[model samples]
Structures are given as structure tokens and as C-alpha cells.
Target chain A: MKRYNVGIVGATGLVGRKILEILVERDFPIQNLFLFASSRSHGKVITCGPYSVSVEGLNDDSFKDKHLDFVLFSAGKEASHHYAPLAAEAGAIVVDNSSCWRMDPDVPLVVAEVNPEDAFKHQGIIANPNCSTIQSVLPLKGILDKYGLDRVSYTTYQAVSGAGIKGIEDLKEQKQAHFPHHIHKNILPHIDAFDEDGYTFEEKKMIEETRKILHLPNLKVTATTVRVPIENTHAIAINASLSKPFELNELETVLEAYQGLQIIKPYPTSEMADGQDDVLIGRIRKDPTLPNSVHIWCVADNIRKGAATNTVQIAELFL
Target chain B: MKRYNVGIVGATGLVGRKILEILVERDFPIQNLFLFASSRSHGKVITCGPYSVSVEGLNDDSFKDKHLDFVLFSAGKEASHHYAPLAAEAGAIVVDNSSCWRMDPDVPLVVAEVNPEDAFKHQGIIANPNCSTIQSVLPLKGILDKYGLDRVSYTTYQAVSGAGIKGIEDLKEQKQAHFPHHIHKNILPHIDAFDEDGYTFEEKKMIEETRKILHLPNLKVTATTVRVPIENTHAIAINASLSKPFELNELETVLEAYQGLQIIKPYPTSEMADGQDDVLIGRIRKDPTLPNSVHIWCVADNIRKGAATNTVQIAELFL
Candidate 1:
């Protein structure tokens, strides 16, 4: 078996740490592991398999000495925007876990299960879709394939973990550090910054990245992204209008058969998807008002399937 | 002003307590207040207006000599089923907050602001719509009145208080006493019992009660009700398709002018609605995919506007 040297940018962050754990759990063939983060996390020691790697602060020349096969970036968009290109230019394929490169025409926004072929189309940078969008599109992809999707509307119950470490702390400490309001026992209907059209940036990502990943540029999509007080996992209520009619059982079968998905009978809650890799789907039913529309409840570990595990899966496609 | 004798059944429960607070807050014209509860709560003292009242256990002869003008029932359906009619027969008009009388053909389900006229048409018992339904209809009524509503879809972020005292305890103690699953730091997509068609009883209540309250019996409506870890407020994402196109500002004006509705611009979250009587409306935007359709975010204190305040408002109609 061939081994490769790999680098994880933003190693001390939530998604970055999960990437390290997943890489070890999946036993990715790595001859050398490099960890990089902001200066605040410099010298922090993180263990990966038999290697004890210290987090190094990223500089313009950080990736120059590392003969990296893959570099997973979970740093914020600013860090990715600054250093991801530098790492990519230094001869490594960058799998970015930020919104910076997602809509870039040259960058491939890849969900490993839904669009691995798109991963191969990457021009040195592969962008992972937003956590909520990642879980949503898996079920949507199956429906779009069999029934043909005309329109989709989403109402998300997103966990604090999606906002990163401070988000989790905000819920734990009952503080409003990362959110606009106290999220301990409240629900924030706003996720990312608002766009001029009243849609948040997070909603826009779900709308645009979903269209781009499905290769359906004009598929109609709208989203209401909300932050709930949960610690992990996000539950999205997806209402989609299909171009073709489908029986409830037929629709269930298609989703169950889809790769990287699970059907939890009756209903799926956030607890069911906590720490799970597969997107947990349940509450499948017809939207009686529309001719061929259905409502689906989807849940998944946002940090895993939504970020870390997805980026790792994308990197595994090359193996 | 003529003061009237008022009787309250289930005088110790969550909504029952809120009703007490609202009555005192509103300074309703009350001559004498009577409190009744199950045998477990018998002999408990409750202060109402200028009198200290003791809760009496309900029996066949409970209301025989009271000459009660109005009775509000917030007890469970079984208790309301047996006690409400007895009170009504004793010359008292009963306003029931249970599901038992909501769908009864003879009973009129009412949201105080939206359909006060129906309150007078009640023969003896008037029904209070479900907490979620009460808040949703206030805005939907505005839309239906201005631009005919063709279809409506709802995704609810409901608080634990909607489940009454036990539901609140479950979240505080990290237990699942009332809900089927753990709700602390979690989201449960299932609320109430599931029907054969996969809709929970709570979802059905939202769908049925909404149509009834709006007097649009043939209106197409669907709902997905989920329980979040919040303590007080319920927020709903309402997507409606209208029969006619609407300018954004025009729709805002219509909703703003609607009684009992408040437009909280940018966003209306659970915190914004907590402890408030008005239904807070926000995040109004066009659903770009569908013509003549828009999205609305609705939030309110489920215990207040959703239950207690609404029932009290109905009582005020007779005053």
C-alpha cells in the first residue's frame, strides 16, 4: 500500500480536530501528518495514529517543505482564502471546508457521496458544501434522480456545533458570544449574515451549492436556516416539489438505497444523528397540497458529514 | 361595569396558571372566582382578585349552585370531556383548551383577534385552537383576507412549555418524561401521537384548526411540528402560495395592520416572543421559485398567545 503525507489546516478548531480523528479511524494511508493553525494554537500537540504532531502556525512558506498529497482546510473562509491557494500552489490538492471557494467556477463543490466525479474535476481546490446543505442534498439527490426535482424549500433546526467551538460554548455557558441572541433556550432564525434579498449567506450557499452540485443550475431552492440550542447534529425539514409522481414506499426505497444515507422509521431526531456519518432520514410523507411534492426530515452530524468526514471522504476518492 | 362569576377547571396546570396571571393583569370584571381541579390538587388555595379561593374537586354536584357565568377548562381532554358539559349545563359558557371539543361540529374554534365573531355563535362550549395554530392563523388571516391563500406549509420550532409543566421539567432535568425522546440539547421531529397517515396529532391540529379558524374549510394546508429545547416561545416558518401576486410592501402593510400581530423586522426569534402577547412576525420574503408566494417567520409565547391569552381574549368578548 502506498502512503502519502497529509496536512490539516486549522487543526485545533472543531472541524479540524474531527478531521484528524476521522483520518485515524478510517486509517487513511499517511506516511506523514502535518497540523497547521493560527498563531494562538501554535505548539499544541495533537496525536494521529503513531505520530505526535505539533500544530504549526501557517505562513506563506509553510507548505513549501511538506510534500503533501492532500491538505484539508477547516479554517474560516478568510484563512482559507489567504492560505489555501498558497498550499495549493505548493503542490497539494486542497479540500477546503469554508464558503470561500464553494461557488468558484474553477472550484468543485463536492459532496463525496453525491458528487465524487465532481471531486475529480477540481482545479487544485475542492470545496465542501455547508453542513446543512451537505445532509440535505443527499436525500435530494436521490429524489432528483428518480422523480426529478422542480423546487425545494428548507426549514433547518441547526445545532450550535455548526457555528464552531465558540458556538458550542455559547450554548454551554448560556452566553451570546457567537450568536446575535442567547441560544441556550432560544432559536435564532438567522444563521449567516443577511443578503440584500433577505436570504442569509448560509441560505444562499444551500441554494447555490445545491444547484451547482446537482448540475442543475436553475433548480428552484429556498431556505430558512435557524440555530437551535442542541450540541450536535442538524435536522432539516425538506419540502420538495417533484417533476414526476412517486408513491410513499417508492420514495422511501429510493432514499434508503441511496449511498451514505439511512432511513429511521417513524421519525428521526437530532439524537439519532449525533456522531453518525450517514445522513439520517425520516418523517417521509406526501405534501397533500401539491400534485407531486413530499416532505422529508433529514438529520446528520454537521461536523462529520457536514464538514470533516465529507472532506476526508473527498480526499479518500483519490486513494 | 358588571362583574361576573368565573370558574376555572384544572386551575393548577401551566396554562391554567397563565390564565390566572392574564386575568389579574387584564383586570377582568370578576365578582367571584371559582377554582376546580382533580382530586390530587383539591384544597389548594389560590388568590384571585380580592378573594382567596380554595380549589374544589370536580364531581356531579360541583357546579350545581355556583351560578357561574363562564368556565375555562385547561385540563386534559378526559377531564374536560366530563366536566365542561356539566359546567355548561349549569348556566356557564365553557371555553375549552383541550382537543376534545375543538373538532366538534357544534363548537366554534376561535382565535380572539382573527375570529371573535365566532365566539358569540357558540351554543355553550367554545374551543381554543392549539397554541401553534393560534399564532399561525393571525398572520395567515391577514394574507387570506388580502390575497386569497391557495396553499400553506408550516415547519414549527415549538417550545417545551407547549407540552405543559411536565414538558418543561423534562428539558430542565434532561429527562424524557413527557416527550417520547430526550429533548434537552436535542430536537424531536415528532410531537404528540402519530396518525396512520404519518402526521403527528399536533401537526394535524395545526392543519385542521388553521382551516377552521380562518373559515377556509377547503384551504390546502400541511405542517411539520418539532419540539426544540426552548422553554417559552414557539416559532413557525410559514410558506404560503397566494392566489394573487403581492408587492412586498403591500403584504407588510396588511400584516402590520392585522390585530394581535407585530412585525419584528430582520428576524423574529423565540426570545423576541417570550412573555409577549402579540404574535411576532419577521423574515418576510418572496419564495422566488413559486409565483404569488411568500415566506413568513412567526413567533409567539406559546403559553400566552398560543394558549392562555387566547382563551382569555375569547372570554373578553362576552365581557
Candidate 2:
């Protein structure tokens, strides 16, 4: 195995931290590691493989003249827009965990298991799909490959952590003060920033990314994205109307035998899917309204499969 | 105002308790009050209108002798199946909160604000739609009526209370133990029992009830229902594609002028909808894939609009 030099941009954020944890847990071959953060975190130290490395402040100079094998970018869109290209220009293949370049014509949106082959065609940068989209389509890919999909109608119960560390802190602070309002006990209707068009940024990603990744620009995709108080996993209730009729047994066979998709046979409960790495799928049945439509319940650790795990998996494919 | 004699079935459950509180708070004009429960709660006392009444054990004879004006059935389906007919046959109009009568051809599914007139023509019983369905459609009723609905794809983040008192207690117990699994921090895939067909009953209700209430037997409706750790509200992400092309302004106008739907237009966060009584609608926009499609985020206190509040409002129609 050839060990590679790696760096994580936005090292202090939620997804960045999880990527570090996963790299160590999965024991990926790492010859050298670097951590980058904003100016405020410049001198902080983080543990990586028996050594404590000081976090370097991010700037265009941070990537100047450095020969890096891979750079995992988990910062917000603005930072990625300003920094990802600099790192890529320095000969590092940037795997961005942001929406900055996802829909760009030149950038390839890759879900390792679903489209690892697409990585070889990346134009210096590869983009990870939205957390909700990543977890949602993982289970559907194999099924969709076998039976053509005409439309998808999905509702998401997304965790706050998908918005990063601040989101988690907001819910925690709200919970502790008994803030006269029940924060954790209620489901929030909003997730990310609301656009002038009224859909949150999160909902828009589901609409746009699903089409691009599936290579079906004309496929009907609609989403309602919401932020609930949960801190870890994101779950989706999918009512997929198919172009071809599929037997329940055939659908289960397709899901069960598929790689990267875990079928929780009887019915997938959130408690059962919590902390699991693979996309947990259950409650497969035919939709009565349409002749070939089917309904499925999907759950995945949003921080893992939705972000970190997918990034690491992409890195693995590069190796 | 004409005061109607009213009785409550399954008066010890969570929704049943909420109904009692709302009725008292609203000062509904009740000519007489009767509370019925199972044998386990027969001796319990519940106060109604400055009077303390003992709960009588439910039996065939419970409604056989009383000339009741109206009865609100909040018991489970089995109880409703056995007792709802008995009450109706005895000449007492029944507003059933259980799923038993919801899909019956003779019963009319009513959402007071959406289809209050449907209650007047009830053959014997008026059925309340599922909590998830009630909240999702209240905002869309006027829009769908004006523009016409082509299809609906909905996913629900339902509260544990929708499962009754035991479900709420289960999550509370799980949370107190600080069990490796934090109930509040996780999402559970299962909301109700899996039937032989593999679809949870809650998912089925979302599909069936929407069709019946909208009178769109052929309308494409797909639902994924999950039970979250929250105690009160149920939130849904609804992606509705309309039959006709309508602008965002027209949709907003329909929502703003619609009865029972409250538009939480700016930053419609869950924090805003908690403890509120009306169905909160926000995050409305056009679906990029289909020109006529629209996406919406809706939230409502499940124990209120989903159950108790709706039941009490039904009684108000008679008063």
C-alpha cells in the first residue's frame, strides 16, 4: 500500500473533525497529515497518528509550493470557492464537502460507490452531493439501475448537525435554558438559508443534485427539507414511482445484494439506523396510487455517510 | 347557541386528555358530559364543567341507554370498530378520531376548516384525517382548489405522542437512562407496526386519508412517516406538483388567504412553530425540475391539530 500525504481544510468544523476521526478509525494509509483552520485557530494543536500537529492558518500562501496528494475541503461555500482552486493548482486533488462547485459543468459530483469511475474524469476537483442527497440515493442507485425510475417525492427529517457545529450548539443552548419554548421537543420547519425564491438552500440541493448524479435531467424530483433537533443522523421517507413494475421480493433482492446499501428487512426504525455507517433501508412496498410506485424509509449517520465517509471513500478510490 | 350533550371515548389517552383541556379552555357549550374508559380506568375521576364525574367502564351498554347529542371517539381502531357503530346506531352522531372509520365509503373525512360542510352530510360518522394529513393539506387546500393538484410527495417527522401515551413514555425512559442511544438525539424509522404488506400503518394513513379527504382517488400521493423523539408536533416536507402552471405569488396568495393555515413566511424555523396551534407553512417555492411543481414546509402541534384540537373544533361545529 502506498501511503499518501493528506490535508483537511476547515479542520475545526463538524464534518472536518469527523473526517479526521474516520481516517484514523479506518486506518487509511497516511504518510503525512496537515490541518488548516481560520486565523483564530492558528496555534491550536490536534492529535494525528501519535503526533500533535499545530493547526495552520488558511490563506492562499498555505498551499503555495506544497506538494500534497489530497486535500479534503469541508469549509463553507465561500471558503471553498476562495481556497479549493489554490490547493488544486498546487497539484492536490481537492475533494470538496461543500456545494461550491457541485453543479459546475466541469466538476464531477461523485458518490464513491455509486460513481467512483466518475472520479477519474474530475477536472482537478470533485464534489460531494448534499448530505440528504448522498444518504437518499445510495440505497436507490442499485434499485434504480435495475428498475428505471420516473419520479421521486421525498420528505426529510434532517438532523441539526448537518448545518455544522453551530447548529448543534444552538439546539443544546435552547434545550438547557428551558427557554419557555420546547426546542428539542419540536420539529423545525427550516434547515439552511432561505433564498428569495422561498426554498431553503438545502431543499434546492435535493432538487438539483439528484438529477445530475442520476444522469436523468428530466426525472421528476421534489423535496421538502426540514431541520429537526436530532444531532446525528438524517432520515428520508421516499415515495418513488418507477417506470417499470417491480415485485417486493425483487426490490428487496436488489437492495439486499447491493453494495453500500444496508437493508433493515422488516422496517427501518431510526433507533436501529442510528450510528450505523451504511445507508439503512426498510419498509419497501408498492405505492397503491401509481401502478409501479414504491415507498422506502432511509436513514444514515449524516455526519458519516452524508459527509466524512463519502469523502474518505472518494479518497480511497483515488488510491 | 345550542348546547349539545357530548361524551368522550378513550378519555384517558394523550389526545383524549388534550381534548378535555381544550374543551374546558375554549368553554365549549356542553349540555352534558360523559367520560368512558376501559375496565382498568373505570374508577378514575375526570372533572368537566364544574362537575366531577366517574369514568364508566366501556361496554355495549355504555351507549345503549344514553340519548347523546355527539360522541368524540379517541380510542384505538379496535375500540372504535366495536363502539363507534353502537354509538351511531343509538342515534348519537360520532366524530371518530381512530383510523377505523376513516376510509369507509359511508364516512366523510373532515378537516373542519377545509371541509366543514362534509360533517353535515355524514351518514353516521365523520372521520378526522390523520394528524400528518390534516397539517399538510390545510395549507394546500385553497391552492389545490384554485390551481388543481397534479401530485403530492410528503415525508413526515412525527412526534411520539402520535403513538399515544405509551410511545411518549418509551422515549422519555430511553432518554433518562442516558442510554447509549439518546432518543432525543436520534430519529426512529418506525412510527407504527408493520403490517403484512410491509408498510407501517402511519404511512398508509397518509396516503389513504389524503386521497379520501381531497376526493382525488387517482391523485398521485406518496408518504414516508417516521416517529421522531419530539413530544408534540408533526412536521412534513411536502413537494406538490400542480396540474397547471402557477407563479410563486399566486401560490403565496392562496396560502395567505386560506383558512386554518398560518404562513410563517420569513425564516420558518421549527423554533417558531413549536407550541403554536395553527398549521405553520413556509419555505414555499417552485420546483426546478417541473415547471408547475411547488415545494412547501409545514408544521403543526400534532397533539393539537393532529388530534385534540381538531376533535374539539369538530364539537364546536355542532355548538
Candidate 3:
């Protein structure tokens, strides 16, 4: 194996830390690992496998002269916008876990299992879709290829951690919240800023990104993104109107075949997906309400399959 | 004002406690209030408007000797089945918050704001629909009447209290759970046992009870019932296809005019409805994915409006 120099931007953050941990777990071919975060996390030491890398602040000089094999961006869109392209321009391929470059025509959105081919189409930078959408699309890919789909509607029960570390802490304490409501014992229907159409930005991502990844430009997608008080794992109740109908056994077979997917009977709960990288799908049933439509339930640990694991898998393709 | 004798069965339980609190809050016309519970809760003193009533154990003679004007039953199915009929036979009209009588042909399923007239048509016992159904129907009634709904689907975020005090304590204490999975920081899609059709009994109740309450006997209704980690309020994301397309403003106006329904713009969250009697509706928008369909977000305090308040309001109708 050829060891390559790797960098994890925003290393002190939640998703960033997960990416580091996963990189170590997978024993990636890394000659030297670099950790970058906002100035506040400077000098913070994070241990990854045999390497103890001290987090450094990202600046104009950080990506200027350094040549790296790959860099994973888990910072917010603002930071990703500022530094991801810099790393990509500076001889390193960037796998961004932000909404910054997701919809950009030049940046290919890649889900390792679902659309690995799209990774090759990337112009130095690849986008990882929203956690909710990533878990949802993995199971839908094989079925979408054979059965085809007309309309898909998602009602997401997202965890507080999807907002990142601050959100996780908000639930642990009672005083403040990253969410509008007190999230300890409540739910917030708003995920992101509301658009004029009344659909949220988070919802729009699930709709648009699902279509882009599936290579279905004309797919009709709608979503309601809600934040539940759970600490991890986002659950979605999906209703998809198919273009064709097949045996129930066939649908189960397709979903169960996903490498990181589990088809548990009765229904998938958030707890079952915690700390696991696999996306769990259950409560599979034919939607009697709509012709050619089915009700599917899917759950995934927002940090693992939704974020860190996906970026690491995308990087593995390069090795 | 007519002061009538009121009896609250299962007074020590979650919903029963809420019923007691609400009866005092609303200052209902109660000449005498009698409390009844299981053997374990007997001798507990509950203070009301002007009297402290000690809850007594239910026995064969509990309902046989008393000439009660009205009885509200929140005890389990078996208890309600045993004692409700006895109270009804002894000349008291019963409003039962149990599934045992909900689907009975003689029992009219009532949501006070939606179907007060159905309360009058009761053959001895009026059934309070499931907590989820009760909150959902309050907002749909006016819209269903004017627009004529085709298919309505509910995805519920039910609170722990929906399962009674044990479920609430399970979340609070981090101890034993009524659910198979830990209820704290998790979600359970299985609410009640699964029927042969793969739908949960809670989902079935929303489907059947909504159809019955709206008097749209053949209305297409489907539901995905999930128990979220919230302590109060069952929030639902409802998609209803209208038989006729009307102005969105007119739809909002009708929903806002419903007596106990409040149409909060942007979206209604679970925290906003806690301890309140009104069913909060928001996030009202047209769903382009489902033709002639509108997306609705509604939240109501499951113990208050979903159970106790609805039962109390039903009693107010007879007052």
C-alpha cells in the first residue's frame, strides 16, 4: 500500500473528529496526518492511531506550499468555502462534508456505495450529501435502478447532534439551545432556514441532492425535516411513488444487498443505529394509499454513515 | 350553569391526572367529583375546586350504587370495559378514552371541536379517539368540510406520556422501559402491537378514527405512528389531498377559525404546545409532490388536548 499525506480540516469539530477516528480504525495509508481547525482549537492534541497530531489554525499560508494527497472538510459552509478550494487548488483532492459545493456543477456529490462512479467525475472536490439524504438514497439506489421512482416524500426525525457538538450539548443542559425550542423534551419542525415556498433549506437539500445523486433530474422529491431530542441517528419515514411495482420480496432483496445497509423487520429505531456505520432500513410495507408507492423506514447514525464514514469511504477510492 | 356529578376513572394515571387538573382549570360544572383508580392508587387524596376527594378502588358496587351524571374513563381497556358499561347502565353517560369502545358501532368517536354532535348521538358511551387522532382531527374538520379530503396521511412524533406515567418515568429516570428500546433519546416506530396488515394499532386508530370523526366513511387515510422522545405533545406531519383546490388563504382561514385549533405560521413545534389546551397547527403549505395536497404540521399537548381536554369538552357539550 502506498502511504499518502492526509489532512482533516476542522479537526476539533464533531464530524472532523469522527473522520480522524475512522481513518485510524480503517488503518488508511497515511504518510503524515494534518489536523486543522479554527483558531480557538489551536494547540489541541488529537491522537489518531500511532500519530498524535496537534490541531493548527487554518490560515492563508496553511494550504499555500503544503502538498497533500487528500483533505476532508467538515467545517461549516463558510469555512469550507474559504479553505476547501484552497486545499483542492494546492495539489490535494478535497472531500467536503458541507453544503458549500454540493450543488456546484463542477463538484460531484458522491455516496461511496450508491454512486462511487461520480467520484471520478469530481474536479478535485467531491461533496457529501446531507446526512438525512445519504442514508435515504443508499437503500433507494438499487431499487431506483430497476423499479424507477416518480415521487418521493421524506419526513425526517433528525437528532440534535445533526446540528453538531453545540446541539448535542444543548440537549444535555437545559438553559440554551442551538435549536429554537428547548430540545431536551421537545421537537422542532424547522431544520434550516425557510424558503419562500415554505419548504426548509434542509428539506430542499434532501430533495435536490437525492435527485442529483440518483442521476434522476426529473424526480419529484419533497421532504419535511424535523429535529427530535435523540442524541444520534436520524430516522426517516419515506413514501415513494414508484414508476413500476414488483414483488415485496424483491424490494427487500434489493435493500438488504447494500453493503452498509441492514433490513431489520418490524421497524428500525434510532437506538439500533447508534455507533454503527450501517444504514438500517425496516418497516417496509406497500403504501395502500398510493398506487405503486411504498412506505419505507430508514435510520443511520448521523455522525457515522451520514458524515465521517462516508467521507472516509470516498477517500478510500483514491487509494 | 348545570352542576352535574362527574367521575374520573383511573385518576392516578397520566391521562387521568391531566383530566383532574383540567376539570379544575376549566371550572366545569361539577356538583360532586368522584375519583376512582386501581387498588394500588386507592386512598390517594385529590383536591379539586372546593373538595378533596380520596380516590377509591373500583369494585362491582363502585358504579352500581351511584347515580352519576357523567363518567370519564381513561383506565385500560379491561377496566373501561368492565366499569364504563356499569356506569352507563346505572344512568350515567360515559366518555371513554379507551380503544375498547372506539370502534363500536354504537359508540360515536368524538373530538370535541370536530364532532360535538357525535357526542349527543352516543348510545351510552362516547369514545375519545386516540391521543394522536384527537389532536389531528381538530384541525382537519373545517378543512375537510369545505375542501373535501381525498387521502390524509399522518407521521406522528408521539410523546412518552402517551404510554402513561411509566413511559414518562422511563425517559426521566433512565431506568426500565415499556418499549423494547430505550425511550430516552430514541424513537420507536412501533406504537401498540402490529396488526396483521403491518400497521400498528396506533396507526390504525388514526386511519379509522379520522374517517369516522370526519364522517368521510370512505376517506383514504394512512398513518405512520412513531414515538419520539418528547415528554408532551404528539406532533404530526399530515399530507391531505383535497377533493377541490381552493385558495391557500381560505384554507388557512378555515383552520384558524376552528375553535380549539391555532394556525401558527412557519411551523408548530412540540415545546409551544406543552400544557396548552389548543391544538397548534402550522407549516401549512401545498405539497407539489401530491397533487391537490397540502402539508400540515400540528402539535398538541397529548395529555391535555389529546386526552383530558377533549374528554372535558365532551362533557361541556352535555352541560
Candidate 4:
């Protein structure tokens, strides 16, 4: 086994820290570990396994001397937009977790299990799908491959953690910070900024990304993303119209055999998916209303399988 | 104004208590108020604005001599099953809040604004739609009456109070007494008991009752109802494919003009809908995936508009 140099940007944020933890847990072959953060987190010492790294603010030459084999960027879109290209130019394979490069025709938007082959086509950068979209497409790929899909409708119950630390704090402290409204005991239909057509940016990410990942540019996709008060994991109610007719039992079996998708019993809940690495799927049933349509309840830890774990898995594709 | 005797069965339960409060808040014309409860709540004295009534255990003779003009039953199905017919046989019109008689052919299931005229045709017992269903059909009716519905899909974020006091306690104490799974800090895709077809009774209620209330027997309806940890209010994400093409602005205007439906600014959430009598509608947008289809986010106080308030409004139809 050959060890490689690994770097993590935004290392102090929620998803960033999870990335660091996952690297250690998976015992990835890492000869050197580098940590980067914003100016406020500079000089913060973080440890993983036998490695202790101090977070450094990104500079023009930050990645120049690193000889980094892989750089995982969990920073927001603005940071990723500024720093990801610089890191990629510095010769590191940047697996960016922001929405900046996802729809870029040159960049491959990858779900580790669903589209590992797409990772090889990356031009120094691989874009990780949105948290909700990552869990959704795993099952969708199975269905699309077997039955074919005509349309996809997503209604998401996203956890506060999807918004990072401040979102969790808002729920715990009962404050109306981070989120636009009180999220302690309330639900918000708005996730990201709204677009001109009334679909939020979060929804557009799911719609566009799903079509791209599935290699179905014309697949009709719509999403209504909502923020719930849960601390971790996300649950998506996926209603999809299949392109072909099939038995319900056959469809369940097909999903059961799909990689990275778990057919959990008694239906999957947010708590059940928390800390898990796989997309836990349950509540598989026919839509009854539409021809060859089905309803799938998909749950996954938004941080693990959705963000950090998927990023790490993308890096693993390199080895 | 003619005042009449009103009876509230299950007077000590959560919805029952809300019914008592709403009646007082609305200053419902009441010559005398009678309270009935299960054996556990017998002898408890509850006070309304100008009346204080002791809860009595339900007996065959409870409504025989009370001369109750209207009886509102919020007890669970078993209690409502045994007592509702008895009360109706005693010449009192029964408006049940349970699922006992919702699909009964002789019973008219009504949303006050959508189908109040059905109340007049009730043989004896009128049924209140399920909490999730009640909030759902308010907007569905608006859409159906305007553009005609081809297919309907519902995804619900129901509050714990829909399960009554025990559900709220389960969330507060982190107990799993009322629900099959832990609901505090968690989300459950399963609500009520599951039928053989994998749909929960709650989902079935939404599907079957929506068709009944809208008087569209052949309508295509599917639902995925989930229980979130919120204490009050329920929000539903409804996706419908309409028979006729609609201009988005024209559809909004039609929904705005619909009675008992409020086109609220920003998107309606559980917090905004709490204690509100009307179904709050928002996030109206075209479903870009399906032709002539649109998405509507509907929210309402599940206990009020969904249960007690709708029950009271149905009684007011006789006025």
C-alpha cells in the first residue's frame, strides 16, 4: 500500500471536521495531513489518529509546496470558488463539496457509489452532489437502470445540521439566527436563496444534479426542500414515475441489491440513518395514482453519506 | 339568536380541550354545555367562558336526556365507534373527530369551507377529515375547482399534537409510548399503523378522505405522511398534475379567492399556522417536471383547522 499526502480545507466547520474524522476512521493511506480554514480559525490544532495538524488560512501559495495528492474542500461556495481553483492549479485533485463547480460541464458531479467512473474524468476537480441529492440518486440510479424513470419529485425533511454549526445552535438555543425563522419547533419550506422561478437554489441543485448524475439530461425533476429541527440526518420523500411497468416486489428487490443503498426494516427514520455510511431506504410502495410510479422514503446522515463520507469515497476512487 | 345545548365527548383529551377553548373564543351560542369523557377522566370539572361542566363517563343514557343539539366526539376510534351512533340515535347530530365514520357512505366527511353543504345531508353523524387530510384538501379543492386535478401526491410534516397528549409527551420526555419509534430529535416516516399494502392508516385517511371531501371518487391520490417532533401545526407538500394548463398568476388569484384558504406571503410553516383557523398556502410554483402540474405548500394548525376548529365550523353550518 502506498501512502499519499492529504489536505482538508474548511477543517473546523461541521462537514469539514466530519471529513477529517472519516479519513482517520477509514484509515486512508496518508503520509501527510494538511488542514486549512478561514482566517478566524488560523493556528487551531486538530488531531486525527497519529497526525496533528494546525489549520492555516489559505494564501496564494498555500498549496504550492504541499505536494498534496488530494484536497477535500467543505468550505461554502464562495470559499470553494476562490480557493478550489487555486488548489487545483497547485496540482492537487480537489474534491470540492460546494455548489460552485457541480454543474460545470468540465467538472464531474459524483456520488461515490452511483458514479465512481465519472470521477476519473475530473479535470483536477470533482464536485460532490448536494446532501439531499446524494442520498436520493443512489436509489434513483437503481430504478433508472432497471425500470427507467420519466420523472422525479422530491420533498425533503432536511436536518438543521445540513446548515452546519450555527443551524444546530439555533435549534438548541431556541434562537432565530443562521436560519431566517425559528427552527426549534417549526418547519421552513425555504432552504437556500430563491431563484426567479420560485424554486430555491437548493431545489435547483437537486433537480439539475440528479439529471446529470443519471446521464438523463431530459429527465423531469422537481424538488421542495424543507428545513426541519432534527439534529442530524435527512429524510426525502421521493415520488418517481417509472418509464416501465414492474411488480412491486421486483422493484424492492432491485433496490435491495443496489450498492450503498440499504433496505432497512420498519421504514428508515432520521435517527436510524444518523452515523450510518449507507443510504437507508424504506417505505417502498406503489403510488397507485400514477402508472408505474412508486414512493420511496430515503434517509441518510447528511454529514456522513451526504457530505464528508461521499467526498472521502470520491478520493478513494483515485486509489 | 337561538342557543342550543352542546356536548363534547372526550372532553379531557387534547383536541377535546381545544374544542372547549375554541367554542369559548368564538363565543358560540350555547344555552347549556355538556362534557363527556372516558372512565379515566370522569368527575373532572372543566370551565368555559360562562359555563363550568363536570366530565361524565359515557353511558347509553348520556345523550338520552341531555337533549344535546350537537355532540363533538374526539375520542379514539373505539370510543367513537361505540358512543357516536348511540348519541346520534338520541336525536343529537354527531360531528366525530375520529376516523370511525369518515368513509361511511351514510356519513358526510366535510371540510367546513369545502363541503359544508354535505353536513346538511348527514343521516346523523358527520365526520371530520384527518388532520393531514384536512389541511391538504383545502388547497386541492382550490386547484381542482380551477384547473381540474389529474393526479395528487402528498408529503406531510405532521406535528406531534395530532397524536394528542401522549404524542406531545413522547416528544418532550424522549419516550416512545404513543408512537412506534422515538420522535424527539427524530422524524418518523411511519404514522399510525401500517396496513398490508405498506401505507399507514394516516396515509390512507388522507387518500380516501381527500377523494370523499372533494367529491372526486375517481381522483388519483397518493400520500406519504410523516410525524415530525413539532408540537403543533402540520405542513403538507402537495404535488398535483392538473388536467388543464394554468397560468401561474391566474392560479394564485384563484387560490386567493377561495374561502378558508389564505395565500400567505413568504412560505407558510408550522409556526405561522399555529392557532390559525384557515389553511395557509404558499410556495405556489409550476412543477417544471410534469406538464400542467404545480407544487403547493400548505400549512395549518392541525388541532384547530384540522380538528376542533373544523368540527366547530361544521356545526356552524347548521346555523
Candidate number of the best DockQ: 4
lDDT of 3 by residue, A145-176 (tens): 77888899999999988999999899888646
TM-score of 1: 0.99
Q: In model 3, where do residues sit more than 4 Å from their true spots? A: none
Instruction: Give residue B31's lDDT in candidate 1 (0 to 100).
Output: 90
Q: lDDT tens digits, residues A51-78, model 2?
A: 5778999988998766788999998899
DockQ (Cα-based) for each candidate: 0.87, 0.54, 0.79, 0.88
Q: How much lDDT does each candidate structure score?
A: 0.91, 0.80, 0.88, 0.92
Per-residue lDDT tens digits for candidate 3, residues B1-319, read 7688889999888888888888888888888788999889889898756769999998878876667999999998999888898899888999999999998989999888787888888879999889999888876787878888889989989988898988988888876558778888678898999988788888898999998999888888889999887777889998889988877888999988889889887777787899899889998888888778898999999898888999988888887
Q: Per-residue alpha-carbon lDDT of model 4 for B169-224, expressed as tens digits?
A: 99999888998889998889888889999999889988899889999999888999
Question: Which pairs, if any, clash in model 4?
Answer: none
Q: Alpha carbon lDDT of residue A241, candidate 1?
A: 93
Q: Indicate whether candidate 1 or candidate 3 has the larger DockQ.
A: 1
Can you tell me which runs of candidate 2 are displaced by over 4 Å?
A64-66, A175-183, A217-219, A241-243, A288-292, B64-66, B89-91, B175-183, B267-277, B288-291
Residue B101 Cα positional deviation in candidate 3, in Å, after optimal superposition: 0.7
The candidate, 1 or 3, that scores higher on lDDT is: 1
Candidate 1: Cα lDDT at A200: 94
